[model samples]
Target: MRQSTTTIMDSQVNILKYNQYFLPVNLKVAKTATTLNAKGILPAGTIIDATGKVVNDGTAFGIVYENVDFNNSMGTENVSVLIFGFVDASKLPTAPADAAKAALNMIKFM
Candidate 1:
């Protein structure tokens, strides 16, 4: 018997109306080779690369709140985008060594 493998790729970003618990922060990001939009097409849960670019294959740093469009000048510019999203605590530079300890600290302090 022979077996085959399958791969799935998501190209569209989800645009949400509102998120009550979401705290969004803006980031200046550049376009990757695969990105189409000037604002960039980053789906929720997408990861950021070392150069501060959004890569589908990188380690996640945050979750996109909505489909964002940064280039309102109609492609006349290729400037870095100012996008916003919720930061992933686990990916934070100052994230605690212990998950439980982080959760406890969040509950007690924040």
Candidate 2:
């Protein structure tokens, strides 16, 4: 018998530009391994769509508030969605598109 091990490194990106006051809503995120994050770590500022999957289209629901480790699990997990706040776009793993920006008007992408 053989055993294998995998270690995921910690995230160092600061996605939130300003969060002194913001609105958060609990939502279920899709557990699609490839879509969530290629490195298995979903960083903050990632735009979520109606299907709870990562979307770069014009339709955006909200922004992820903190780092979420999917651990390569194929199941949904409830995460905090920032409806209103300042997010640093440069810090995001995949910056949202203009349509996403328009959809998430409440969130200011700096």
Candidate 3:
């Protein structure tokens, strides 16, 4: 038998500027040197590449839709990525680089 556990956390503020449209992609998050939040979770709005590695460069693929704590039994975890939507940049953990912003053309950062 196999078992899995999932923890649900709420965001204080909505990162999406509007509900017009948002695309969610399931991806296996890769372990990286990127710093985690106080809760040891990769916060929502954190940018990542197609390989699921945290990045702030032009290689950015999409934004995380929820907090993810992959430092557990499993070395990697599947997470939801927002490929398209209007996001409030101010709510992001860090400001995305110009190259990254340009790469995510479908995502509009307010």
Find the candidate with the highest lDDT and give its number: 3
lDDT of 2 by residue, 1-110 (tens): 54656676675566777757578888877776226556677677777876667788887888777777777445777778788878888887687889988999888878
Candidate 2 stretches greater than 4 Å from native: 1-9, 72-74
Q: Which is the better candidate, 1 or 3, if ranked by TM-score?
A: 3
TM-score of candidate 1 versus the correct structure, residues matched by position: 0.34
- Pairs that collide, model 2: 58-99
How does candidate 3 score on lDDT? Answer: 0.83
Report the C-alpha lDDT of model 1 over 19-96, residue by residue, as the tens digit. 333444555454432243433344443334334445433233333344434333233323222133233444322332
Where model 1 places Cα greater than 4 Å from the true spot, the runs are 1-18, 32-34, 37-40, 43-45, 49-52, 55-58, 70-110
What TM-scores do the predictions have? Answer: 0.34, 0.76, 0.81
Worst 10 residues of 2 by lDDT: 32-41
The TM-score obtained by model 3 is 0.81
User: Alpha carbon lDDT of residue 1, candidate 3?
Assistant: 68
**Higher-lDDT candidate of 2 and 3:** 3
Select the stronger candidate by TM-score from 1 and 2: 2
Q: Rate the local accuracy (lDDT) of all candidates.
A: 0.36, 0.75, 0.83
